[model samples]
Target chain A: MAQGGGRVQRAAVIGCGTVGASWAALFLVHGLDVTATDPAEGAEERLRAFVEGARAQLAGFGLTGSGRLRFVPRVPEALDGAEFVQENAPETEALKRALLAEIDRLLPPQVLVASSTSALLRSAIVADCARPERVLVAHPFNPPHLVPLVEIVAGDAATAARAAAFYRGLGRRPVILRREMPGHIANRLASALYREAVNLVAEGVASVADIDAALCHGPGLRWAAMGPHMTYHLGGGAGGIAHYLAHLGPSQERRWASLGNPALTPEVQAAIVAGVAEEAAGLSVAELEARRDRALVGILKARETVAPDPAQDGTAEE
Target chain B: MAQGGGRVQRAAVIGCGTVGASWAALFLVHGLDVTATDPAEGAEERLRAFVEGARAQLAGFGLTGSGRLRFVPRVPEALDGAEFVQENAPETEALKRALLAEIDRLLPPQVLVASSTSALLRSAIVADCARPERVLVAHPFNPPHLVPLVEIVAGDAATAARAAAFYRGLGRRPVILRREMPGHIANRLASALYREAVNLVAEGVASVADIDAALCHGPGLRWAAMGPHMTYHLGGGAGGIAHYLAHLGPSQERRWASLGNPALTPEVQAAIVAGVAEEAAGLSVAELEARRDRALVGILKARETVAPDPAQDGTAEE
Candidate 1:
């Protein structure tokens, strides 16, 4: 993963909404010229604001690199001479097919197109392309400037490797999806948790505020470092994940039986909003996000040193 | 929310495993007297290491508060003079029931006993206890030091208020589960995601590294800050969750219909493990955890300032 202008030189972000804007910012901050586009009338302004927000966040990370960005009025303009095209168009399947087809026809054959769909499959998403092999899913987290994960699901196995190299060029940790599943991996897990939380609150067993609190405080914390299987590995001492699973497998199975999402009902919906509302009792979304980003900045800065070696520092033990 | 000595000043932890040690360390770091008991002979050494690990984490957060911690030989001894007892015993109902019985016999009526059970229900686990009112589930994350969430499911709703305050006092975000379910909130969601990841790989759709990579790069990034519902909320702009749901609900449901986590067969298990192992490359479990925690520490520190606020940061969009 060479940091300098190695393989990926310039990038194209073919949308300017939450996901697209984030992708563009990451590319620009990593020193790649970004050409972002959207059909919306106010996309330029939104893109600019979005870029500023992302830059604010990247600057917090110390702006280790630099690049330029331009917002064009048209799609072809945005895709101008780009080596890679990241599509953050609407989630509609038809829209993606049409968009990919257009990019495929216009952009050079060597340019790869990445989709930022949360739920759609890469094969399903790229089925219509003449060069579908070059199109894959390069889905990133919302506000990619802060969070560290970028999932690269190959439309085909070959595309997966190419996507990995591209994301690596941007200094992002790209986890590949061997197989495609709805909601990919994390979202499905999150949705499951959320559904149950709603169910609990809906059933009057607890409040929405409480359910979120449980996760944000409990597993959410541990998960910030390791997944449940890996955590259990440590929980099992030398027994490792397999041993922990073997011992706790029955319990895990029993637990899994009861894991389902809560039905979204009127009362339940009200409760959830109110509960989360209370949890966010004093801060606005922007304020919370600001606070979140600020803390994230400090966290990432600290991580630059302490994070790469948690065990030696006793940071990983308990 | 007042940071003062007038708050509760005592805590107790039983079964000093990773979770228990984290609980004890946190309780002590927050200026509470924590008495920890474990039948394991190496408990002291482990506890010291765990405490030190937690202390370093707490120190990073600038929490200068201190609390007393003593290793008691017996469960009752650990519970003695403790206002709150965090039960981190193994995830066994039988073991928990037996321990609760003994704890009920010794602890006064007012003392709260919170079990750190990952997926167990409070009622079933506390069924054998005579004074079940004082016993509830206050499950924390694996390395409780880094994460700030605490799921406080009141066994009978009797301990709800106290559990909330106690956890909040420890600088944790406490979520209440209106009802008991497997994996609480985060794990349930997590399982949903992991299950699908497993299913996909088992079916030969993709590889393990690719699946993990997809998540790490995609939804995992968003989840690290704003979760799915909220992410969708923003996606919908001012429309909020209801608006987003109204429009995308069917599609989301369509995605949900295909989300499956089948029983792990021998073949599936081998494939899943092999996939993850290949993903692991050459890193050991401990090494992986250390890397995870260190990275998490940085992420968390950066996000610390992004505290959830509701007043000025209106969350109606969620």
Candidate 2:
């Protein structure tokens, strides 16, 4: 194990909101000794409930591991004997800098630290910390315990490398960002697509329902297995992605030029809200969430039935 | 079934290419008597091989039926006594217009005539047809037998409605495009996303491999089940999509403004090709395709296991 490395045996989770709680559950399920700290009143009860829900859900992924968990009210206590710290504090720059600085002062520089801030730059988040090299962003998608993307960005190469390794240890797919960018990589792609999706609705190109169908039943299905680049690579036939770029690149650029930039005016918002209501067909948010979660579980399990990632089958190489 | 449709007991598949053969397999599995026609020599051997492969794949979805299939050398012979025609001719405006026009003259005016053109607009393809109202684009994602989306666009309201019903009857999700637009609904959305993906690679923000992981693990997973609008609806924490737009729409627009527009220069193309090769790890295109297909089947079956759509259980009302 390197200076700030090795398999993460003891970890601290600072902040017990939905993201933090999910991270805590994921860590615990992976058999790590965990101490979670959150300043919110009734944090213990809420965190426990969230972890319990996560434990039940983790069973669907065929993951069952026993890891000790403790809830402490103090940052110092949470930092005690921790090998790794995942800071899931609110997405406020100043608050995170101060909190991370405190942890940096209390813990040894060898302990890897990652924040789950979706939008904040990692450098900015660690600006006040004494050992900024040990800090990075380990942003996860919603339902961190389930979805397997952990984007590692902005730290010393070693720290970023260790963070990526740590996440891989947790049976997650970690992607490295070479440079800092707004919304990172995935969100940038998502934002680009959603801009057009919203524009299509505003321009009356298609109803919100049909637009959703255009994705979930269409490109979205392909995307779940292969991404845009790979899908286009396949679309190129025997000549592969090179042929696609040579032949179809112009058409793609033309389509991009025509993409709309719809402003979300009150009327547009109302139209979207009404369209969603009609498409949802009176299904409540909770009902829809359950449905979505169930489908997610099934898809995840189905992917596993085929080829499992070699990393997923072995121990972490931290 | 409407005037143009009557539960479609007899169907014709013109131009026995990959798309045509797959469409034939789907129709046959659904118990429709299919007559396929192609003029290319040895097309019978190729089409049969494709359909046989499709039949094995369709069995994974628990679909099996005895539907007689006939191969003829002439389109007129194939169209004789056929109630529905799915034309998968070459994607040339002139060729498609001539073929569609010929079919229009020979077939009943009420029979639905759909061209499976991925790029050509339906309006242009049907411009020479006598009954233009009966012709439209019924674009399917690659390997139509597996992917469930059938994008219906650029036809009269009644024709679009009936086509949607016909596809739904075949247990496919048919999304209607309100207006004729280049690339249609799904491809336009896909093109928007892919343009950004290529830009990210060109800009060195991320590698092609990391970008693909960013999606297949992140938003792509959610998208497989729910579209972006609805996913954001859930993100609103019970307030639904309207609340999401009111709160987060500005952030989305900001991200959109920052999206890159990189030209697909030669260097960029080479980088993408090499990146894909590294990611592919020497798996042949056919091998990767089979893997993708297996995963797709698993996901489709898994979704069915959870929530059975009521429409999937009943006949379509055209």
Candidate 3:
């Protein structure tokens, strides 16, 4: 929504994990100066290599020469002069509180700090920060350089608009959760689906590969275009959502009745591992990651053209 | 893989509703001789227009000369000599069972009769058919010609292999569920998610738009390539799924505590409608459908080079 003269220029990635590294790379590729940091030993080398791989991906998207990237030794160094901070640190209430306090302490009051924690509440993370109003959650998927979504949940109203705008400046789509809860929106939805998927595997009803296949092959692609409510609306013909619920509701209700209770027992874990291993088949973890990254790069680039900027945020993750 | 001439020649679209019509058009434009039929009155004209739109899409895919189109007025007429059948009749069991029985009475035993039912069990549909051995569920998304994945669920051993091979012949990415369930795999996974989405909307945690924005902008896009299991695997780094479950498992469990039990009460329905309507803004249902179709076409064509075959039992439909 800009005339190309002004938007986000400086960004920071806190925590230097896979998601963090991807965020740093994405920010840099979008022409923002990205300062990435972590306190772990050898974090710099790890982030450097991660950024290198992401740059190759960014280059594939014709974005390698757009901006700058740097690795810092500490959180304060990462936050220096940064307009936006994407925190990807471990999802601990204590660590996040301490980190936000430090970030707010180091940066100007207006700087937006986003927690990349996939599950923690924005309120909890910014509890001890001086300007909690400026801190929010902008959770991005791993390999953020490719995935375009930025789930922005504000700690308080003051930060919501600015946080949303800052992410928009980053060339990322951000959805604001009016209120906070565990898993926010996307991850929570994903939790529900994963729970059932795991349950199905545990019950010997389906294989992990088959379960994934059912989604990516069927509704997953449908969801890539439309969400469940809308899909049911269409399925209803002229009757719309109300009609769909009336007719198909009985069927779904019946199916729901038989749906397994999501008990994550040891037996369930074994089923998941074996099922996933079967699903992985020939692909090693590294191979799967590369494959996922490559496909994700294509998907992100493709969606940049068609993906909506509007908020209708139900992800498998939600 | 087929040896020489790796081309799809013959295909059939049974039950010419929305999904059926889309399938007919897609197959025709893909250069396969599509035998389209439905029991409903005026299905021919509807099928014709649907094929025209799909032809335009096929042209977009540079497949102008890829396939031919044909429409028949009768169920047996469509199934005659067809290599594959995409049945898109009503989802009701009585209707599906009757239709499959009729289809089985006419189609050759070698031909693959794939149902387009989104939720009905493959075995149940093929239960009373004469050549039930060749009848498998080849469920596809709304627009079959565009979405790359085809959920191929073979009820038994013989039908499974045939289903896989047939989808391969059609150039679809097929994933076989080892067994059957109420909604098969995708819908079940999605149901879990949708149930929560409905809950979240009803609970006022986030606006419907924001929930959707979280997906289209974030994890939904990543899922276009990799799945939840793989995503968490990568998130786990060197530790793999084992590490992920052990570490994040507690967090996930905690979040699950807050997940509202799904309730389709009046208040919840009103809340859902209001929230979703806000997300839709001014777009009409037709407009939404058009948008979904266009995007689906682009995604499917772009990934045409990467789709797997459906002939093998394991990878049935699309």
Say which candidate scores most in lDDT: 2
Q: What DockQ, on C-alphas, does every prediction get?
A: 0.35, 0.64, 0.42
**Candidate 1, DockQ to 2 decimals?**
0.35
Task: Encode model 1's per-residue lDDT on A1-318: one tens digit a residue.
Answer: 112324667788888887788888888888888888899989889888888878877876666456788888889898887877889988888888888888888976666788888877777877778888778887776567666666767757656766766666566666666666677666665555555555666667555444544444445544554454444545555645566556765655666666665555566556656655565555566665565566445544554321121112312111
Compared with the true structure, all predictions reach lDDT values of: 0.67, 0.83, 0.70
Model 1 stretches astray by more than 4 angstroms: A1-8, A64-68, A124-128, A153-158, A179-182, A261-299, A304-318, B1-11, B62-68, B76-80, B155-158, B280-289, B305-318
| lDDT score of residue A214 within candidate 1 | 48
Clashes of each: 60, 0, 48
Question: Could you give candidate 3's per-residue lDDT for residues A184-246 as a string of tens digits?
Answer: 788888887777877777777766666666666567666666666777766777766777776
* Proportion of true contacts reproduced by candidate 2: 0.71
Q: What is the TM-score of chain A in candidate 3?
A: 0.89
Off by over 4 Å in 2: A1-6, A304-316, B2-5, B304-318
By DockQ thresholds, what CAPRI class is model 3?
acceptable
Worst 10 residues of 3 chain B by lDDT: B302-311
Assess every candidate by TM-score. 0.84, 0.95, 0.87
* Native interface contacts kept by each candidate, as a fraction: 0.41, 0.71, 0.45
Error of 3 at B63 (Å): 3.7
